[model samples]
Target chain A: MLYIICMVAGLLLSRALRLERIARPIGWAQTAVTLILIACMGYRLGSRPDFIHELSSMGLMSLLYCIVPSVFSIALVYVVTRFLLKEKKNGRNRDSW
Target chain B: MVILALIALLIGTLAGMLAPHSGMLAVLTNATDIYLVVLMALVGITIGFNEGIVDKLKRHTLHIIVVPTCIIVATILGGVVCSFISGYPMNISTAIAAGLGWYSLSGVTMTNLVGAQIGTITFMSSLMREIFSFMTIPFISRYMNYSSAIAPAAATSEDTTLGMMIKYTDAEHVVVSLLNGTIISAAVPFLIPLCLAVF
Candidate 1:
């Protein structure tokens, strides 16, 4: 949490200093970090002694669990955005309130 | 820059694969979250300071906020429906986990709570969400005002998308997207877990 706060503060300070060009570099850095975090989490998961057995037991059920929520969320978002939002002259919708 | 980050991520994954000890690789892996948050904040500040961002927000604040809200709501509803259809108890915690693709935080948090497979599912789902949002931004913008596109686009990477939106679309959308991303990202850590616990 403190780390996040420091990061936000640093960015704000950078912006105040007019260093807008640095944003992309910073963003790329963040992406790299996020990937590492994911890998670490994977490693931790893989290291557990029961993990393989648990995974095997999960089998097809695991796949279903994963796919169902994901597809549903994306489809839901798409449907609502498409149906509820009014289209403009260009067939584009405005993105405000 | 995204390319560079991707390369770095590739290298990290490879290192993890090749390493003798898993924990050694885990340290390297965990670094990505810190990098992402800092980078996102920097992107946010840049967008926040842009004059055109404010102008765009003034022009289309309503569209910007509402569209993303609709998308998020849809995501939640879909999660619920899928849970029911799959015969798995609806796990709101899991749905919330999938909703925030920030991966580093939400993924870890879910792992600590629900176990790894579920966490992996959340991580992958979130990644998909981000990628989908990123790839669709241009197409979405063509149909909607840039501000509206910013909402979902920023759902993945505020800084990267905001920059792209500013360069390619309306300036006002860039600022509004940044602001919106900031707010949503902040909520993700807590909301995902809460939602997971609820359903």
Candidate 2:
């Protein structure tokens, strides 16, 4: 995929280049770009003629779908990491683990 | 950052409502893919800049696989439960859950497989998943474990939400998050369709 390629390319480029000085700027740029994309997403959603109707009609169902799966994911991951991975509650073994 | 994101969303929505066909809106919407690509590259560079990232990734190669696998199974189980509770049919519910927070792809795919209503639901649900992950990552990382924090992020953990991972968790978990995201992202397309057809 293009996304994967771009990521790998960037990674290789960064590794080859001396970019320590610009790291903060790179982070800022990433955040700004992310904000723009988020705004664009909002624009796309809001520009729909039926935005309000769609939200009102499907919002609850959508929320349900989001919450249930995410909760399950969190719970399961917690169990696995705590029991199987033997990770601590506060994640003190961050790097050592 | 979260506050800024919310403000951007609100402002963008207002602008869209006021000038739905504005040239700026058109440009921003059309160039979304470009923005996304740049974001991905930036994220990659961030990771690459970390001198020890590769070593960390290698250290946890086996453990990395476990996170995504658990997420996938938990998500599907959640879908089954959702189907029973929402009465939306097992296939549709499961398909939506299989999205794994990749909104645009899953939303469009579900739309094509089913219809606009289901598509819209998929879009909103997955979008909510991303937003919720943004809000909850801090708490999850603090109270729960670093790995569990990645669960709410799913596929987006690689790029869109990698910043959160970087901010809240450590380098080791960030490496795991990236791998978890890649695995989940690869699975979403196949999983959604498979859920639709099989369940």
Candidate 3:
């Protein structure tokens, strides 16, 4: 709820304030935030004794469960989008949008 | 960037284990939620900051529809196959897959709708989805179309994972990703319930 609001506010604010000059830096900030979020999640996992104990047993299944879906999604989307992009490669409509 | 991000996570995990300095680490854990909000706002600013993206989005609007449909179908199919191999019911796997990458919601929803057993699997699997999301962003961007790279992140685009996508993909994909995130997030309530009801 608030997340959407803040994001919309930021977007509208940027539009009004002409913040394009600093958009690059904001992008860097996003990467930094992502890194911090990932590390924090790792730290939380480490602190959980139950998770660590169960981690060994669930390791392989967990890996399979995670990788397979992502691989499938990527493979499907990649193939279709590649065909789409290739079709649009001709100069006639290139970069028009 | 992905490697460095993983290294940072490794170090944070090691620190948490060695120190268990619950005081500071607890604060850090709580702070992540706040940080997430800030990041989302920054993403909006970046998106709004770009004046031309709206035009780009209009041109590639079809992508918003096609790509997510592929991801959703693939994810559900994979989940069904995986459930069969793992000796679970197809319904359980479908609900889990329907979670996309939003672990917290999936975890709780599965637990309440099903049992703790399936719920635990949902939590872990979706968490893995998120890890894979962060892991694949750069690699996919390099080898595949930027739009497809967003597949791994699934539902995180509205929040935690959006940043990396914006960093790796182009302006147009970001718009698509935001749409993907919202759609997947919205789908959660309906789809998870649908999977459970069918079971």
Total clashes for model 3:
0
The 10-residue segment of model 1 chain B with minimum total lDDT is B1-10
lDDT of all the models against the reference? 0.54, 0.81, 0.71
| Model 1 DockQ class | acceptable
lDDT of 3 by residue, B17-116 (tens): 7766679777876575587578667766866754565665576677767777888889888887788777768887788788788665565456556754
Comparison by lDDT, 2 against 3, better one: 2
Of candidates 3 and 1, the better by TM-score:
1
Task: Give the TM-score comparing model 1 with the true structure, all chains together.
Answer: 0.64
Clashing pairs in 3: none
TM-score of candidate 3 against the unseen true structure: 0.61
**Of the native A-B interface contacts, what share survives in model 3?**
0.59
Best by DockQ: 2
TM-score (all chains, Cα) for each model: 0.64, 0.68, 0.61
Candidate ordering by DockQ (highest first): 2, 3, 1
Ranking of candidates on lDDT, top first? 2, 3, 1
Deviating ranges (above 4 Å) for candidate 2: A1-54, A94-96, B1-57
Native contacts, share recovered per candidate? 0.23, 0.69, 0.59
Candidate 3 lDDT score at position B187: 63
DockQ of each: 0.28, 0.49, 0.40
User: Any runs in candidate 3 off by more than 4 Å, and if so which?
Assistant: A1-59, A85-97, B1-59
**Which parts of model 1 are misplaced by more than 4 Å?**
A1-8, A49-85, A88-97, B1-52, B85-98, B131-154, B157-183
